[model samples]
Target: MGTIWTPKLNSYSGAKYLRLAQAAADAINQKELLANTKLPPQRRLADALGVTVGTVTRAYAVLEQRGYVYAKVGAGTFVRAEESEFKNKQINFATCQPPLTNQISVLSDAMSQLAKSPQRLTQLMAYHGEPLKEHQLIFSQWLHKRGITQQPEQIVFTHGAQQGIFAVLNGLMQAGDTLLCEGNCYPGIHTAAVQLGINIEPITLSDEGLDLSELEQKIIAHQPKVLYITPNNQNPTCIQYNLSQRQAILALTKKYNLVILEDDVNYCLSSEWHSPIWSIEQGSEQSEDPGHVIYLSSLSKVFCGGLRQGFLLVPNLYALKIKQAIHSQCWMISPLNTELACRVIQNPEFMGQREQVIAQRQQLCIEMGQRLGLKQRWRGLNGWLQLALPLKAHHVVTALAQKNILVRNGDDFNNHQNFIRLSIGDAADDKIFVQQLAIIEACIKSLSQTAYSVV
Candidate 1:
């Protein structure tokens, strides 16, 4: 080692090992500890920090696991050189999906089980007007677990959440009709509106959630036929509406005679399940008409994205129209895919494994953000980082792209903000995630400095 170094851990609040690791990451980020500098030995570091030797050992191991350093057999651990070129390979933090887990093996096992039953496989391969009643029942039970109490008859299967969104827009609204949504909303809504020739009016969102007064004002001004929202964890922004907000929205739908298209696709990745707006609307006993909310969810976030399995729970009045739209588009979703989804969800260990993977990825992202001093907001696997003034979102995005890393610019979702959306779902491993984030941190710092210089 060039010189003995002591890391300050007082500002960090975590387990001793994690705090030490974060301190080291801070040093690396600040350039106080350069690349290829050998780290202090475990005993010396422990004594300097006044902690147990095992804590130092664990902290060093964490550094290695995060791709910050490497350990030689006889030599002490040394900081790894910063990676510059990715050879055109991109580290993606754009598309939102659950982190990689045992989903592939789960699918493989389900496939093996299906292969052994020729009659069932043959049935699944055939065409049908709707999903098998058994499959619908399974999904109904799945929804029940999530606190949604819709019946099996209400379920309409579609290719994925994107298709479900399109089908709803096509079935309910005419070419000239208007739809209301959050000012900063999911990009899919914009695409669907443009394709269907439907006009969209945006309602401003406040710090808490949607600004209720603005929503009502827009509803009155536009006479919109439907309102699209993501209640559990809103896309791009990752803002989850509170119970009071949900109730207020439900009340507005009833007041304006407006239909709500509630997308809860990210609910599966949530650590805590909240009652959906659909459930609250349906469960109210005082209302004679309880069919104001159309619920949409998908198995892609919970299981495998390639399965492309999603479903919508429409009210009795609109079920036929929505099903017709689905039928007119693709006749029916592939029964084989639905069957595979059913099997995956039914696996005894599926839920536990899914929760574990989500928690681990979330924790990793949180730690990375802390070490880099990046302020972020998170929901499930998605995160939003607002760039400071003079440092633009697009510039950071371009810089990251030069290093073969991909992330979504906030403008993709809303033009009024300067931020970037990050989804850790596609990171190959924790080490890769940490390495990419480190690069992202460096890029942002360099751009920030350049921006301040020009000003």
Candidate 2:
């Protein structure tokens, strides 16, 4: 199994894993690896390639997650049945998701710590108000940790950032009222707007962020009721907006009588961050309307998505309305996730682990993408390269699914199938994950047509 290659780092390059994974996938796609084809033992591949068993394990995990490959506990990993999608269509690259952190210890610790006080859990088992004081503190601390002190009272709780979004769009604008979003935008918000019968207007975007001149023109002409932005960590494209551009955006928010719905859902995973929209010191509140801006963020990006916890910061003026809308449905967020979140926030070790986990996943994501010769049509978390898909994001996503890997394509965030995303930190061990990446490369090679290309 001494599959030695040239250069030391070459063994670990993101391209290496990409190529290897693609090779494995191609073997299956070409039917060279038959239905239920059991993958070679991890040690065998590791020894064969003169690589660590961990690497092999990662590659296998990648394959398994993509649905192209699978493994039973004591049994060996194998390819799915030929009738399965992995055997059907090619792979899609348009999905965007961060790696899952398998922190059994963390979960166990949280459970144990919370178990000591079952009373707290029991107390919160019932419904709480829309603005849960507990969650607000957690959210405020989260923002403050990032150097933002925009007040907890200004924050309202929501099911997820998605719900916060619904409130922002719902509370600020009326049906038939126009709004502006990134030319390339978060599709979730786009869908919500369409569902509510609100008009969505797109503003052209640059790598730095939205084009200020164009944004200004749109604001001045249409005088949109609201401006939706993902400033801290822009999504789908995953670009970080620059300081100048962000400041300019704040200026426009004031000038045009515009309501700013800063949809900052991705702030948690952002490798790089911008000052929050609220922190921008436009003018004194007594002198002007700082109430024009609204901020939304979530715990889902940092913790489990099932946490079902998100927050909104509005000018005290709109807090009541937003809370009222939240009240009508789901009444208030489930107190269970809230108290658990509070417990998580109180745990000092949690923050340290979060940093470590994000960095590790970021590194893995970079290496995986690089080994495959994946190029960013744009950038990503922590200054990493984000590749633009060469096919319709949905097609690439579905294709990847056929391989057994679950991913979020651009269409999840945008109606357009143009962009696709891949994350290194998602799900995989070293070697097996590399193997899975190799499958993606194969899919890219064999799969064609809907090329959205790059910026």
Q: What lDDT does each candidate get?
A: 0.81, 0.65
Worst 10 residues of 1 by lDDT: 80-89
Using lDDT as the measure, which candidate wins? 1
TM-scores for all candidates: the values are 0.79, 0.70
lDDT of 2 by residue, 1-455 (tens): 22222223343324343445556766677777777767788777666678777556655665665567878888888878846654444322333333443333345456777788878767777666755676677768877887776777887778888988887777667889887998767778878898778988898878789988888888877879888988877776766778888778877777777778887776344446666777775234543547778877776656556666777778887887787777766677777766666766666545333445456645655665566566553333222233354544556567678677756655555436355665544443344455666776666555553344221
| Alpha-carbon shift of residue 415 in model 1 (angstroms) | 3.2
State in Å the error of residue 301, model 2. 1.7
Q: So what's the TM-score on candidate 1?
A: 0.79
| Candidate number of the best TM-score | 1
